[model samples]
Target: MKKPKTTNRYCKFCKKRTSQKLAAVKTGTPSSLKRGSKYRMRKRGLNRGFGNKGKTSRGALGSWKRYGVKGSKKISLKYTCGDCKKVGLSANTIRSKKLQFE
Candidate 1:
């Protein structure tokens, strides 16, 4: 949380104090590559009619190996407007573990 190279703030299309330029809005999807437990597999059907095969979830005692992606990557802040150049987004949402805009 260190984004203050410029933040006079109030730039509703340059209506007042403008000089905002700190950005870091990296919003979603970055956890290596989500979903691949084979749809929690378990599909060996039609043994005497057709055919189908899939397997993965071995829970209850294996707990399905506890998959991945508990949810992450949600940081925001992209306020450009240096004078009606317009671009805003840092109204409210300030979770921080890291975010430094120099």
Candidate 2:
């Protein structure tokens, strides 16, 4: 997908319409200290000591590479106000194989 470098958009902070610069939003890596990561680590430890864990004892049937493939990537975009220098997030996410700014 090709997006315009600059577009006229409404600036909520400024309370008016202005020409804004378009930029893609990049996500940062997850922290190991997060709550989800800690819970997963505790769950794995519990399965190790138990005699019978039912279906979990068998573990995964196959490698993760064999399934759950996605066709496209979700891209997030944001616009920067030219006057106020404040950034605003786009309302919707785009799914595409490639994204380019024109």
Poorest 10 consecutive residues by lDDT, candidate 1: 37-46
* CA lDDT of each prediction against the hidden true structure: 0.60, 0.76
What lDDT score goes with residue 67 in model 2? 30
Instruction: Give per-residue CA lDDT, model 2, range 32-61, as digits (tens).
Output: 554435334445657688543442233341
- Scored by lDDT, the top model is 2
- Candidate 2 residues lying further than 4 Å off, grouped into runs, are 32-68
Clashes of each: 0, 0
Task: Report the lDDT tens digits of candidate 1 across residue range 27-53.
Answer: 453343234433223222333354332
Residue runs of model 1 more than 4 Å from their true location after superposition: 5-18, 21-76, 88-102
